[model samples]
Target: MALYRGTGSGRLSRGLLLLLWVTLGSKLCPTGAIVQGANTSLAVPQNWTAHESATPDNKSQLPQFTLDDHYWLFAHFCWINFTIWMNNVTGAQLCDWRIISRPYSYLQYCLESAAEKLKFGYPNRIADDYIFKSHYIYFLNCTQDHPVLLDPPEDMLLALIIAPICLIPFLVTLVVCKSKDGKTQS
Candidate 1:
C-alpha cells in the first residue's frame, strides 16, 4: 500500500509522513547512552540468597539492587521491546507492557514490595515455577518478583495430554499395517 498518494505535493501529507517516520524510526535507532548503560557492571552482593534462607535474627541485611538512571532506561526499553516482539511472534499479548518512567531504586522497591506481598500476604496467588528465567526478569535482576495472580497452565500436564494424542494415530497406523501384512502373507 502506498503511504503517500498523488504527487505527494500536499503539506499535510508531507507532515504526516514525517511524523510517522519520526515516531517509528526512533525505535529502530538506539542511542549510545543506552549501549554504555548496558555495559554497567551488576555485581551480585555476597550471599545474595541470604534473603531466601535467612533466619529471623539475620533478616535485616537484604541485598541491595542498584542501577544508574541510564541503565534503568535501557532496562525499560529492553522490556518494552521484548513484550512487543513476543506479541508480534505469538500474534497475541502474552505479557503486558510496563512503560512507566522511574528510577531503578523505585523499580527495586516495587519488586521487593511485591515479593513481600506474595510471600506473606497472598501466598496462594503466586504462580508455580514463578521464578522462571526471562530477559525482563534477568535484566532487572528481580527474579524474586514472581508473577502474582497469574496462574498459567501446567506445562507438564499439557505435554502429557498432548503426547498421547499425537502418538495414537501413528501407533494405530503401524498396527494396521502389520495386520495387513500378516493377512496377505497367510
Candidate 2:
C-alpha cells in the first residue's frame, strides 16, 4: 500500500523515487516523521463488533487470541488496512508528514500489538502496519505534478499475498540501486 508521487526526471526515476519513498521512508525517518507508533495499552474502542477489539491486559496472564479467531482477525486486519489506504489519497491534498505521522503510527501499533500479540520484539509488522502508515503520509504530500496509482489487495490471502508483493518491490529496488551505482562508477 506504499505508493507515492515523486518529482524526478523520467517515469522510471519518478517511479524509483516513489518506490523508495514508500518502502524505505519508515526506516529512513528515525524520528518517525512519517508515522507514529501506536499505544498498545488501550487506544481503540473495546467493542467486540469492531476491528480486533480486545485488550491484552488480563488479570492472570498476558493477552492471547484463540487460534480459530486468527483467520477472522487477519481478515479484519486486511480489511481495515485497505480501508485506511483507500482513504489515503495523494497529491495537492497531501499533508505534511512531520505534522501528521504519529497518529497513524499509533493506530498501526495498537492494531498489530493487539491483534498479533507483539509487545516487544522484532518489527515483523512493519510492512503490514508501518508501511501503510508511511503510504498515508506519502499520499498526503501528493500534488498535481505527481499523481499516483496505489494497488492494495482486497482479499482473504492476507500474509500470503502481502509477503510476496512487499518482497518483489524490495528486490526490484535493490537491483535498480545497484545498477545505478555501477553506472555512476563507470
Candidate 3:
C-alpha cells in the first residue's frame, strides 16, 4: 500500500514525515561559530565577582562550580583543538585539566555555600551568592544572554540511553532510502 494517501491517512503520513524531518533537523543543528580574530577577550560577565583576581595559578582559590557549566563545554573546547586531529595545539588550548580543575572546585565551594543559604528557603545564601560568582562560569561560556545549561547526572544517564536509539533510526533511514533508490533505478 502507498505510505502517503491523498486523504485523512495522507495527513497522518504527512505528520509522521514532518515529525521525522523535525527530529532529524534538530539532530543536525549546528552550534554557534567561533568568533575569529575579533579581539576576543574572555567573555566572562562583569558581575561574576566571585572569582579571585589573582594569577592563573591562584585560580584554585576561586569558588568554582562542579559542572563548571557542564564538562561538555570543556570537552567541546578540547575536540576543537587537539583531540583526534592534526597534532598542533593552535586553536584553543585553554581547557587544560589544570586550568579547568580549580575554578570548578571553587564553584563546588560556592554551591555548598548557596545550598546552606537555600536550606532555610527564601531570603538566604542562594540569593546572597547570586551577586556575580554564582553564575560566573555559566555566563562565561554561554553566548549572549542565554542561560547556560549544566549537564546534571540525569542528562548523562538520558544521553547514554538515547544516543544509540537516535543513531539506529538514522542508520535505518539511510538504509531504507538507499534501498528505495536502488529498486527505482533497477
Q: Give the best candidate by lDDT.
A: 2
Writing each residue's lDDT as its tens digit, candidate 2 over 1-186 gives: 223222233433544454345333323222213322121111221221211232334323223334433423332343344334345444543465554465355545555565555333334443354445556545534554466766556665587778999999999999888998666663
Query: For candidate 3, what is the lDDT?
Result: 0.39
**Each model's TM-score?**
0.17, 0.25, 0.18
Query: What are the lDDT figures for the candidates, one per model?
Result: 0.37, 0.42, 0.39
Candidate 2: 10-residue stretch with minimal lDDT: 39-48
Tens digits of per-residue lDDT, candidate 1, 55-144, equal: 547746443333332233233333333232233332122232352223233433433454454343322122111212233433343334
Off by over 4 Å in 1: 1-67, 91-186
lDDT of 3 by residue, 72-156 (tens): 2222222222111212223343344454444444444444443444343333333333324323523344344467777779879
Model 3, C-alpha of 117: deviation from truth (Å)? 5.5
| Ranked by TM-score, top first | 2, 3, 1
Better of 1 and 2 by TM-score: 2
Ranking of predictions according to lDDT? 2, 3, 1
How many clashes would you count in candidate 3? 7
User: In candidate 1, where is summed lDDT lowest over 10 consecutive residues?
Assistant: 122-131
List the RMSD of every prediction in angstroms. 21.6, 24.3, 30.3
Q: How large an RMSD does model 1 have?
A: 21.6
Q: What is the lDDT of residue 114 in candidate 3?
A: 39
| Candidate 1 whole-model C-alpha lDDT, 0 to 1 | 0.37
